[model samples]
Target: MSSPPVSAPPALEVTGLSHSFGRRKALDDVGFTIPQGRFTVLLGQNGAGKTTLFNLVTRLYSNRSGSIEIMGVDLRARPTVALAKLGVVFQLRTVDLDLSVKQNLLYHAGLHGLSRVQAQARIQAELDRLSLAERANDKVRQLSGGQVRRVEIARALLHKPRLLLLDEPTVGLDIGSRQTIVDHVRQLCATDGLGVLWATHLIDEVRADDAVILLHQGRVLAAGDGATLCAKAEVKDLGQAFTKLTEARAA
Candidate 1:
């Protein structure tokens, strides 16, 4: 007899995810599911609540009322356990300027309960993958902005998390550094089967077949593969397609 097909669980899922401060709603009834092993990018304008959603997913701000699941685990019911299975690189640089690259990575691993020996092995492996092995002992302050960002990436992967969250990760980097980070992320997602949510405003970083969610005015304006979505409108690029979609919806 032929074997039955296997179904993969969603890497990230959210339902009725609404949040507000005073009179303004940052996220309103937003819901979406990201399949396993895809590089999903969330596109939005300023104040569209992309950061707010990231915060909720990372459990930085408690969801007053909503459901969030990461790697099939409900974040609310088991916040700590759920978060441990995920890796995150925020918009801001978080590495210690005074610490050596290796030392910073070791500290991150320790927080995830990785033993010194195990963490060291993992850190070494990641540094090698990033081609930063030669500079492991160099202080972060001595490295260029691009090199420091690589350290943060290495730190996030120290525990081998199933999901990776990058919030505007290349926001302020130069063109070369931005391209480097984008390329590395693409490779990681494809090779390691790590589900990625890359929040950003740059459309060039989006791949033709990658999944994407468009946020406008705190609501999901659209969601699907970026190229597929643009094709439907017969547009050449994301920026134009987004403008057409939102304008048509308004009319």
Candidate 2:
């Protein structure tokens, strides 16, 4: 007899998720699973509810009618517990401009209730990984945009989260800065086995093999490996694939 198929638990899972305002549905029964250690990008145009989904995951906007599980913990049942295993970098720059990089990190560590010694060690390690050790004491405002962005990332990782969520993190950054941030995030996800959900408008930032969910008009129109979807359309890159997909949806 053939063996039964094995199943792997997802690092992040959403089921029957739906949200709406008066006369408007922002998310209509959207569902997807992100396997552990994958770089998953959520793609969409404005008003497609990409950020709304991000907010749902982060619990900024409560999910009135769905389930979200992170690392097997139900977000609604145990929000704090589920959130503890996740790190987030929002679309806006979140670093304290007046605070030194080290100080900013220290504050974040404290927010998670880390002791001084523990925070110090964690901060040092993250700075080293991002190659920001040499300028750790500089105020964030004094640093370049790229450096400030890196500091925000370092702060997010101070808790040693297993899942990282970045919402349009590279928005407004120069080409070089954008590439640098993308490279660092890609490397971190691959090397540390960290699950990442990066929401962005730029198709070039996501790799073809990475998982992708295309949100259109408050609905998920497609979800799969980027390369596979692109191949289905004979597209050379994600940009072309996105154009094809969205155009078809509109038609």
Candidate 3:
């Protein structure tokens, strides 16, 4: 008899994850898996411990309990190997305002140990992909908020990480700009086979086919595709489903 095909591990996985800030528990027994080559929305309202989870995953904060794994590698046991597969665009912008877009990207590339020639090629590819090629020579301060956010996204991808994390990436953008980013990232997932963990409180960003993890008060209330979540909640849309889930937990 032929053996069944073995399945690849998730792009990212968290098991029994928890964190605290002194007396306040920021995350409580949180766990979820992000599949490879897919876009998974970490849906939660502000102060829902979304950032806390990201911090732990990125090693910005020490994980006091539980575990994080990236592409089947244990983060605690093999941090460098685990982190090499991760990319992040934080909620706060980190690019230097005085530096040109290309300069910023080159600096980031150098940090990842890419040589100047290699960095140049990757920089061109990302800038072109993000529609920022014309703006590559312009100082970051010269760009609009939406353009700046695009630069951050491009910079994040320079290292070619398999898993990309974005925390509240569209917080202050116009609807058009927000939608542009949403479309571009979705296209990346389809074309490049990149796995994304997008953290957002915005309900409109969640699509029916996308994987959704509903987090409230640092706990995962639901995990499934958007359509399935709506069906399980007995709701017609994701917004109503989210409200029903959170409110039920509060009660």
Candidate 4:
């Protein structure tokens, strides 16, 4: 007998998501689905509502008008269940400089209600995977900017979330550091079947195969892989295509 094929559920899904601050609309009918084991880039310029969308996904703000599903669990109907399947890294630096690298991570683990043994096991595993186990005892302030970012990533993965979201994660990193972080995340997606939704405005970050959601002026201008977007825009590459897309929105 021939076996039936089964597909994995989307890591993250949103439909008709909209948000506003009084008269200022931040996200307007934003919607997309990120498939399991793929890297999906949310490409947008500054003030393009990337942060707003992240806020909604992390439940920092309410999604009053639309639906969000994390691993097939509705965020509104079961926030805890949905959030359990998700991990997030925001744009701002969040590690406590005064604390040791592991200390910062331990605090978060405690808040998540992970017992000492479980938290330590997960922390060590993630740090080792990131090649950061040796520095666990080091103060966060002593590490370089890039190292801190790596530590934050380790913390996010400690609970083994199915979907990972990073918003402008390399904002202040040097060119080399930026590339390193991007490459590392991409490797995770490929090697571990980790689903990643990375939000950034840097056009260079978009690869031909990775899916992209181009956001502009609080709305989605295009959604597809980099190659498709460039083909649709009739441009030479993602850089030119992104410029064309955003310019159209501005005008």
Candidate order by TM-score, highest to lowest? 3, 4, 1, 2
Best by TM-score: 3
Per-candidate TM vs. native?
0.94, 0.93, 0.96, 0.95
> So what's the TM-score on candidate 3?
0.96
Q: How does candidate 4 fare on TM-score?
A: 0.95
Which residue segments of model 1 deviate by more than 4 Å? 1-6, 232-234, 248-251
**Tens digit of per-residue lDDT, candidate 3, span 99-178:** 99999999999988889999999999999999899999999999999999999999989999988999989999999999
Positional deviation of residue 23's Cα in model 2 after best superposition, in angstroms: 1.8
Q: What is the C-alpha RMSD of each candidate to the true structure, in Å?
A: 2.8, 3.6, 3.0, 2.7
Alpha-carbon runs more than 4 Å astray in model 2: 1-8, 234-236
Clashing pairs for model 1 are none
Better of 2 and 3 by TM-score: 3
How do the residues 24-101 of candidate 1 rate in per-residue lDDT, one tens digit apiece?
999999999876678899988777899999899999998988799988899999998899989999888999999999
Off by over 4 Å in 3: 1-6
**Prediction 1 TM-score vs. true:** 0.94
Best by lDDT: 3
Model 4 per-residue lDDT tens digits across residues 2-29? 2112466788998999999999999999
Arrange candidates by lDDT, descending: 3, 4, 2, 1
State each model's CA lDDT, in order: 0.87, 0.87, 0.91, 0.89
